[model samples]
Target: MGRKLLSLLLFASLATATPAAAAPTAAPQPPTELVTGLSLPWATSFLPDGQSALMTERNSFRVSRVTLDGTRTTVGTVPNSVTTNGEGGLMGIAVSPTWNGTSDQAVYLFHTSTDGGQTQNRVVRMDFDGTTLSNRTVIVSGIRSNTFHNGGQLKFGPDGFLYAGTGDAQDTSTSQNDSSLNGKILRFTTSGQPAPGNPFGTLVYSKGHRNPQGLAWDSAGRMWSAELGDTQFDELNLIVSGHNYGWPICQGSCSTPGMDNPKRTWTTAEASPSSLAIVDDTAYVAALRGQRLWRVELNGENAGATQAYFTNTFGRLRSIVQVPGASAIWISTSNTNGDKLLRSVIQ
Candidate 1:
């Protein structure tokens, strides 16, 4: 072959060999089942040594220690102030950020409760002795609630601030009202006080959301939220301080006049995103109604190259947590009526 022809052929081959920046085509190895027999598992927290996890059951209001071998023992039941209903009950839980045999170490929980005939969401801190719970205290409360759209996701940000995502309590207008804690991501100290120098001088960190179910922070300390939209847009947002994410006004994109658009949006069928975990530069979204795991590459909050996996492997994916020092993702299956947990090892 002529030298010029050979060079052209080599370039063409290289182009064909490179993968496109869309859905990953390489069939990831089938995920191995980790544990089964869980009743609508909601959230998971890794132990300090990463061998065990604490998982919450939604309707049962039960929190249990799940070992790597799939053995489960009930730690304790979350204090219930109201009856468990659709999408209400024990929701999110996180271990104390400063938990190193400290006296103040506790497991924090976020759930919906009924008070005076009005449903409300609250955060409570419960002391854990590795076997049971003692000394439960309400950390923060007064979040509007309803049968659905009770945004219940909590995590400690790298800045040591306790962040909670709240829903609009089925009232679309509340998302835009600054005075209402509903439909916003709240930032507060461990003592449940609003962080000093908040943008609004209150617990409201950012406003204008529908039902935000996922909260995650990247290594750069940037927060991202996954929200369920009303029959239109399911959004993934790069949460910024004091920025408004238009809910009823704007569904998707940046078309709405004073609101920030999502980094990416999907149809409700494609992603009813429940929870998210950012590993390296990739954001993995756990889908509930969509029943899939979405992988979105992150370029400084702006998303690129999206992919989906686990189409029908698990009925409903509730949460995804990265296993530290391992190339695996621990996924909670909401086969509540069925009960199962899965661990996905990315190949």
Candidate 2:
């Protein structure tokens, strides 16, 4: 689609967007470990219940159920997931909030598969019967992939649409090219088609993303994403359908006419953020290279004061999940032998 067409689509979509988020009322809490000793876990998704969560391992291709007591049960592995040869493999997992152990058991996974010399990433759906993941169903496919910038973030939006965050796959042109699926946040139904009422009449929900790895929705149902930049700035963006984020042409604070400014941005060294979770009202971003968790206070869709926690204490935090019904969250470490899970305990 042309730039003007996209802008018009976005304007139409924005006409229905709820007013900016209400004044957030979240207080920061410290995090603690709940489990330890796992291989390259990529993401953690909480079950509808408060305790157990489905956790995905990158190279292992395994999904395990972990509880507050640190006990874990093997859910299953995605058979065709490529090993993490160059940051590509079984990456993100999203469990449906409505999944019942009986008939509706559904879990979605994003993995990279070998496509000759190049790699292709896809999101597949599997049935989780509280024990094993069966009935593999490939939902979305043919997303071109490279070694780096394979954005693998997935979350179910409040409107019950499955949202997948994709990278530009190291090709900057695709970010601005609406025809390409790379560097975009896509919305689809559980059946894997474009969600009804999506802007641009396609799966592409928002475009012009560089390497978006984290996605979460706030209480007001507004979507937010954490994206990595080339060299200068990393962004925390409030995602709006059909809006342009200005990846290659404009990094941070670009005065480009139609490009959207991020709610917040940090230097690359401080926030190679991956996987975000909203707790209370704050958006907690797990910083991979920064080795910390960032707390961004939200006020009407914009960010206020920010804080960093667990700096360098846990090597390369990968995913953070808000403990359901609690003010604390679960933090996972990406350190080689040091990789472990921690939970917060009020002091």
Clashing pairs in 1: 40-336
The local distance difference test score of model 1 is 0.83
lDDT of 1 by residue, 1-347 (tens): 99999999999988887765455533234677777767888888876667777888888888888887778888888875453467777888888766643565578888876545666799888888777866778888889878888888988888888889998888998999999999999999888999986789999999999988899988788999999888988999999989999987888886777799999999999889999988876788989889888998888868998998988777788988877677678888786687677777765
The reply for model 1, stretches above 4 Å from the true place, is 1-29, 81-84, 114-118
Off by over 4 Å in 2: 1-30, 114-118, 345-347
Error of 2 at 128 (Å): 0.9
**How close to the true structure is residue 214 of candidate 2, measured as C-alpha lDDT?**
88
lDDT of 2 by residue, 1-347 (tens): 99999999899778656456454445445655577788778888888876789999888888999987889899888877786467778888889989887878999988897544555898889999888888888888878778888898888888988999899998999999888889999999988899988888888999999999989988888889999988999999999999999988899778999999999999989999888887655788989889888889888789988988778877898887877787777878887565788886422
